[model samples]
Each structure stands twice: as structure tokens, then as C-alpha cells.
Target: MKITKLTNNISLKRQLEGGNEEQLKTVRNVLQDVRENGDEALRKYSEMWDGIKLDDFRVSQEEIEEAVANFDEQLKQDLEEAAANIRYYHEAQKRDGYKLPLANGSWLAQRIIPLDAVGLYVPGGSAAYPSSVLMNVIPAQVAGVERIVITSPAGKDGKLPAAVLVAASILGVNEIYKVGGAQAIAALAYGTETIAPVDKITGPGNIYVALAKREVFGEVAIDMIAGPSEIAVLADDSAYADEVAADLLSQAEHDALACAVLITTSEKLANEVAEEVEKQLRELPREAIARKSIENFGHIYIAESMEQAIEAVNSLAPEHLEVVTENAESDAEKIRHAGAIFVGRYSSEPVGDYFAGTNHVLPTNSTARFASGLNVDDFIKRSNVVYYSEQTWQESAPKIARLARMEGLEGHARAVESRGWTKGDK
Candidate 1:
């Protein structure tokens, strides 16, 4: 990892804005073709990209059951454990409807209603991520969404991963489609003969999927315009260099574009961590991707003090933040912006990703400053309600009329006047 000094007045817009307009245009073309051609377009893309020729685009319940039975028992147990932890965390996020009564013969309240349907897109090209299935679907289930649909591509054998199917079934998401990439996003955003349109879509995919979500925003709701995964570690002299190096590499393994930055008050620890990263990089299965990510985006910034390190962290607004200092919890408390904060050496990235009982689907590309991770609230809507009796309306009419007239809304004033008010002298 390269050590770089921090500068003032840096343009974050240059850092956060997405890359490769040509790739975005390619995604746009795929979305348009799918919108016009429907299932046939999905089949062609699946064959072209994944090398799988599918007779049916949707997975049947029987297939799911067989998958669940045939899957490795130990992996199945691990998934169930992860699912239980996820459900336990998100179940607390489920909100109940509430009502408030006004002193004046009126009632005001909000109703929390779940979306009628939701779509979850899980990437399938590079690896099978059953953890994603649990992370995305369990929240919707806890939120009481009625219909949940899942989309993923088939392998060259034209079979969905057993772990993916088992995870979906465990989460009670029965609707599974084999379409992937931008076409899957289109299928979820706009319904076809086979796939039903959903009110909202959630999940992470390639740049094409991100661009497609940006294009279909008004037509259907999307979770967020997520970019590559990023993690920032705030370390001090007490931090272990090898552990810091491993955590950085964990995020770097995501993709070549992922960022793993360290903001440290101790230059000695920073130099040691760089050496540790070089030592550990030789053993990783995805060393090529991790090395590229570390080479391009990873950096160590030496800070004069802990406060300056924190200032650097807030400016970055990283998706995942790990604080390892003399007092890690105290350092974590000082943080104001981060999608998720993991404190101490024991709290690593994969713990949150797999079994730490927190949502791992977090905001990326500095969006932690404004946005948040996936939660039960993302699957539900709250509608405001107001009820007023005739007496309350009569009491407030003059004020309403005056405000409306002051704003040059004569029609609104007349509407109040027509409610049986006598003409008044001003």
C-alpha cells in the first residue's frame, strides 16, 4: 500500500462520480433491447454472457426443493444460522402503524404499509453468493412484503446454484427467475409475460445493473445507485499491522475498483501494515484482483493526531469503517458518518458480511454521508392520514383562507368561503 499525505479542499465529486460512460451506454442498449423483446431477449443474453441455454426462465418450486435436499448439509446449516441472525436483527426494524389525536376534534397518523412486491437481483457470474440472498430477502419478509422475486443467471450447466435456491427458499421467496444482468433489472422494473413487475427492486450487480437502475428510476423504485465496495480503517499505535492488512485485503477482494484506505496517527504502524499487506498478498486466491485494487485505490494517510484521522474518515464517508485504537469503542463513538462501524480487532469485515448480525448491504462511493444500508424500512412505505370534524374545520377556516389569499390562491379562499361563511369587513 502506498502512503499519501492528505490535502485540504479536495474535490470529492471527482472521487465519487461513477466511471466509464461507454459501459453505461452498453447497459442502456441492453435495457432497451430487453424492454422490447422480453423473455426472448433474456435467453439470448444468458447464452451470450453466461454460456447457458435455458428452456425455462423461471425456477419451479419442485426444483428449489430438490436443490435444498441435494445441497451440502454443513453449508445448509451455516446458511440457516446466518439467516436466523439476519432475521433476528431485521425483525426489530419492522415498524407498526401509529395514530395521534389532535386536541381539536381531529386525528393525525401515519400508516406503515409494505410494498406489494419486490425484486432481488443476485450476481452469478464470478461466484455464488447465498449470503446476498439472505441479506436482501429477509428484510422484505420482515417488512411484510407480499410478493418477492429473485433473479440470477444459470451456470453453464443451466442450473441455479444449490446454495442460492436453498437460501431463497429458507427466506420464503418463491418467485425465482433465471435472468441476469441488465435484462434481469428490466424484467423486474417492467413486467413481461412471465415475470411480474415489482414496486421496487433491491440488490447489487455489475455496472450495467447500476446504470439500468438509474434509467428505470421513475418507473420503479431502486435501493441505491451502489458502486464498488469500500472500507476505511482508523488505526492508532495500538493497532496490529497484520490484522489491519488482512482487513484491507478483505475489501480489496471484492473487485479491482474497490477501495481499502487506512487513516492512522502512527506512521510506524502504517509502514508495518504496508509490509504486512505485501507479505499476505501472496496467499490470497483472488490476489490479482486484490493487488489491482490495492495498487490503484488503497492508500495509507498519516495523521498528526486521532482527531485528524477521524476528520479524514468523515471526509471519505466509507461504506465500512473499522476503528482499532487504544480505546476502539471511544474512537467508534466519535465517528459521525459511516454505513457500519466495526470496533476492535475482533470485529472484521467478514463478520459483518456473514455472521455479525448486521446488514452488510451498505451505501458505497461516499454515499454514507447521506444514505444508509438496506433495512426493513426500505421495503415499506408510510402514508400520512388526517381526519378533521366540521367544528375543527370551521374554527380553522378563516386562518386557512387568509393564508391562501396571502399566497395569491383565490380559488383556495373561495373554496373555504363557499363552506358557508358570511362576508366579513376587513
Candidate 2:
């Protein structure tokens, strides 16, 4: 890991920018092909990207049952527990429609409607993320989204992972498809013979999937354009160096572009964490990827004080923030921007990633400054409901016309005038 003294803020801000034009162009072509060719494009792109040809894109009920039947019982139990926790947390986030009464016998309200259908894209092949299945699907279920479909790349054997299938099945999501990448996104957006178009698409994938989401955003609602995973640990002298190192490496293993940073007041603790990260990286199964991530984007910034450390954390606005200091909770309160905060040494990031009931699909690449993590709100839409009685319209007509005419919109003003009042009468 590289160690640097805290200096320029621009250097930190520049890393947050995600995506490139070349990647966007490739994704655009894939989306266009899928939009024009439909199912044929899905098959062709599946063979090209996933190295397999498929006769059917949707996973059959029998396939889902078989996967669940063959899955490990212990793991299934664990997933069920995680799913329950996830559901419990997100259920509290479910919102109800609200109505407000007006003075002139009129009413203003908002109707919170669940999306008609939703598409969940889970990365497949070598990576199997049943946890991601729980994190993404359970919230939509809580939001009352009825038609939840999942699209994942098939393995060389032309099958989705048993864990992913079982998780989906457990969540009562039966619409699983054997497709992935930009083509899968395009198919979900535009629909094919086998796959129906969805109102929204949510989940994380590679660069192609990210860019595809960017292109199809207007056509269909999307969760967010997620970037590589990142973590920033705010530690002081009281922090455990070994645990801090392990937490940093946890996100670093996600991708080569993933960033793991540490901001601390104690230089001695920083050096200890740097050494521990080096030592621990050797034992990780994904050491090569973690090592590259640590070498390239990993940083240890030495702050003169805790206030400076907190300032650096806010500037970075990382996807995950771990506060390991005296009174970790108080220090965490000082942090204004972070997708999720794990307080103290015992509260590791993976707890939220797996079973702590919090959503792991967080805002990455410094989007924590404004955007938020996935939740029930992502699967629902809010529409304003307005009602105006004849008396209400008559009372407000003159004011409405004056305001509309002030903007030189004669048609708008006349429309308001037609309600009850004329321009000369006002």
C-alpha cells in the first residue's frame, strides 16, 4: 500500500469520476443491437461474452427447484437468516402514501406505488453472490414490487449458481433468466420474446453493465450507476492495526480499481496498519487482485488531528467508512458523508455486507455525497395527487393567470383564465 501525507483535495476529488467514452460506446452498441434484434441479440451476445449459447433465456421452475434441492442445507439456513434480517430492516423503510387537506376544499396528496416490474442483474460465472441476491431482492419484496425478475450470466455449463438460484427462490422470485452483461441489461430494458421489459433495473456489474445502465436509464428507471467498491477507514491511536488492515483488504479484493484508504492521526498506527496490510495480503485467496488494488489506489493519509481525519473522510465520501477510534460512535457522528459507517473494531464491514441487515449495495466512487444505498424506495414510485374544487379554482384563478402571464406564457394564462376569471376581470 502507498503512504502519503494529506495535501491537495483535488487529488481526492478526481478519483470519484467514473466511466469512460470507449466503454460507453461499446455498451451503446450492445444496447442498440439488443433494441433492434431482440432475442437474437441476447443469444449472440451471450455466446460472445459468456462463451455459451442458450436456447432459452428464462430459467424454468424445474431448474430453480433442482438448484434449491441440491443446495447445502447449512448455507440455505444461513441465507434464510440473512434474508429475514434484510427484510426486517427494509420493512421499516417502507413508506405509506400521504394526503394533505387544503383550505379551499382541495387536497394534495402523494400516491406511493410499487413499480409494476423490476429487473435484478446479478453477476455470474466464477463469482457467486447469494448475499447480493438477498440484499437486492428482499427490498423490492418489502416495497410490494410484485414482478421481480433476475438476469445472470450462465456458466460454461449453461447454468446459474445454485446459491443465487436458491436465494432467489427463497425470496419468492421465480423469474430468473440465463443472460448477463450489456445484452442482459438491453433485453431487460427493451424486452424480448422470453424476457419482459421491467420498470426498473437494479444491481452491480462490470464496466459494460454500468455503461449499459447509463444508456437505458431514461427508457427504464435504474437504481444508480455504481462504480468499483471502495472503503475509507478513519482510525486513531486506539484502533487495532490488524483489524484495520483486514477491513481495508476486504474491499480491495473486490476489484483492481477498488480503493482502500486509511486516515489516522497517529503515524505510528498508520505504519503498523501498512505493514499488517502487506502481511495479510499474502494469505488472501484473491491476493493478486487485492495486491494490485492496494498498490494502485490504496492510500494511508496521515492527518494531524481527528478533525482533519474527519475532513478527509467527508471529502472522499467513500462507499464504506469504518471508524476505529476512541468513542467510535461519536467520531462516526462527525462524518457527514459515507454510504455506510461501521463503528469500532468489532463492527466490521462484512457484517453489513452479509448479515447485519444493512444493504451492501452502496453508493460508490464518492456518490455518497448525494446518492444513497439501495432500499425499498428504489422499487417504488411517488406521484403527486392534486384535487381542486370549483371554489378553489375560482379563488386561485386570477393569481395563477398573473403568474403564468408574467412568464410570457399566454396559453398557460388563458388556460387558467378559462377556469373562471378573464384577464380584464382580474
- Range of the 10 consecutive residues with the lowest summed lDDT in candidate 2: 8-17
Q: Mind sharing the TM-score for model 2? A: 0.95
lDDT of 1: 0.88
Candidate 2 residue lDDT tens string, 98-183: 99999878999999999999999999868899988899899998999889999999999999999999998888888899999999
List runs of model 1 lying over 4 Å from the truth. 5-19, 420-426
**Most TM-score-accurate candidate:** 2
Model 1: per-residue Cα lDDT over 238-325, one tens digit each:
9999999999999999999889999998989999999999999999999999999999888998888888788778888899999999
